[model samples]
Target: MAELTLLQAINKALEQQMEKDKSVVVFGEDAGFEGGVFRVTAGLQKKFGEDRVFDTPIAEAAIVGNAIGMAINGLKPVAEIQFSGFMFPGYNQIVTHAARMRNRSRGKYGVPMVVRMPYGGGLRALEHHSESLETLFAHIPGLKLVIPSTPYDAKGLMIAAIQDPDPVIFMEPKRIYRAFKQEVPDQEYKVEIGKARVVKKGEGMTVVAWGAMMRETQKALKRLEKENIDVELIDLRTIAPLDYDTVLESVKKTGRLLVVSEQVKSLGIASELITRANEEAFLYLEAPPMRVTGHDITVPLPKGEHHHMVDEKRIAHTIKKLANYEV
Candidate 1:
């Protein structure tokens, strides 16, 4: 095992995958020479050379579209969209081409590619730099969405995403890039894409979240422990095909649910989880699951965004309701 930061783990995974598979090619704005704005792809350009690890023009459409072309031609391309918000320009390509390629061709063609983007709030970052748009991607049939909350998961999930036969949108929580250190396996290991990880176990309530909101969920758990609330924290590492079995087991044991996420409340990933619970574990629930998420509004700037985002106060309130429910 080796101790590494979240960003460092991502870098190591990309390096390892590139070394192992010659089909894997990397490209993005500044990814080649500058090592990317976050330096997640740092030093790869020199190691892999310009042809395999080079930069493209400042165009998201070209970047993603070209990746689709390369994938059809039997090359595994890893394209980085500088920011979550900046990915809109290439959304059409993702939804139309990359996603539908396999189905449209009836397995004759496959876009085994990874689209990496930094997402979520709580970095005091520039406007539009942190949007939790995982729900939108999950709604699309052909795309797989992944969110890594820690250094270990980041490395493993990245490897898995790269190797997935389908296209994957790999969302990284930017806030925890350097938050803490974790021991990642020195050799290759892949975290399954559609899996959930139980970060903490408890019997009182199950607190579900992904990406940066996960940090807030952990803080809420610590605060609730003072009140004798043994909360279970489920890091939903993947959104598209959520790990419903884990969620079902946790909710069935706790009989309560509090979902936290950086995305807005309207039609977000939490809503999907709540709907799934109603369909599968409605009888086991002591109280109706509640979502504590960003307000259904535009992503705010730094000064006022904190007010709009969900935090421990909202999570605690939800848990209290569950604990004190009469019905």
Candidate 2:
């Protein structure tokens, strides 16, 4: 095992996969020769050769359309969009085709491809660079959405995504790409998709988060430790086809729920979590389920981002409020 940042872990996963499987091809805007905007795909082209790893034009639709064609024809194409917000051009192809290919063919075909993009704020990027529109992809049926906050999960989940028979939307958290490092095994591994990881155990409430928010949530949890607010923390690794079983069990045990996400509050993953808690663990709840999420507006310009970003203070405040609330 070696200490690797989240960015390097992704590169490791891609390199290992490309080496193990001849069907895996990687490409995107500047992803090949330049190694991506964040260099998360750094060094892949050099190792795999241009034939297996290369760059594409600035057309997002063409990128995804090309990926879909490669996938159904038996190639596991790992395509990249510079940023998740810029995936709109390719969004149509993903939702309408990549997502429907399996069901349309009645199991005759499956799009064994992974579409990777860096999403979420804290990077203070432009309008189309930092949006965390996970609910969009998570809403689609055939696609699996994944976000990783650590190097270990980034490597494991990415390998799993590449090996998945169906389409997967692998959203990397730009804020934490190089924010931290961890000792990730220097070997190919897979973190089972649709399974949630229990980060910490507590008796007060269930706190669910993923991606960069996981870092901030952990910080808040530490502060609450002084207050003796025991809280269970869950990392929602896979967004779609959520691991509700783990979450529901936690809610039933803790008697409270708090979902934290970077997307807008309306119909977001937080809403879905609360709804599930209400339906499955209603009687166990000591307090109504709550969430601390981003506002329902465009992630503002860099200057106004602090007002929009969810930090430890905001999370800690909400956790304390929910943990201490008397129903």
How far residue 301's Cα lies from its native spot in candidate 2, in Å, is 0.7
Kindly give the number of clashing pairs for every candidate: 0, 0
Model 2 regions lying over 4 Å from their true place: none
Q: Put down candidate 1 lDDT per residue, 72-182, tens digits, no spaces.
A: 888999999999899988898999899999999999999999999988787778988868888779999989999898999999999999999999999888888989999
lDDT against the true structure, each candidate: 0.88, 0.92
What lDDT is reached at residue 300 by model 1?
90
Worst 10 residues of 1 by lDDT: 217-226
Model 2 residue 235 lDDT score: 98
Off by over 4 Å in 1: none
TM-score per model over all chains = 0.97, 0.99
Query: What does each candidate score in C-alpha RMSD?
Result: 1.2, 0.8
Candidate 2: give the clashing pairs.
Answer: none
TM-score of 2: 0.99
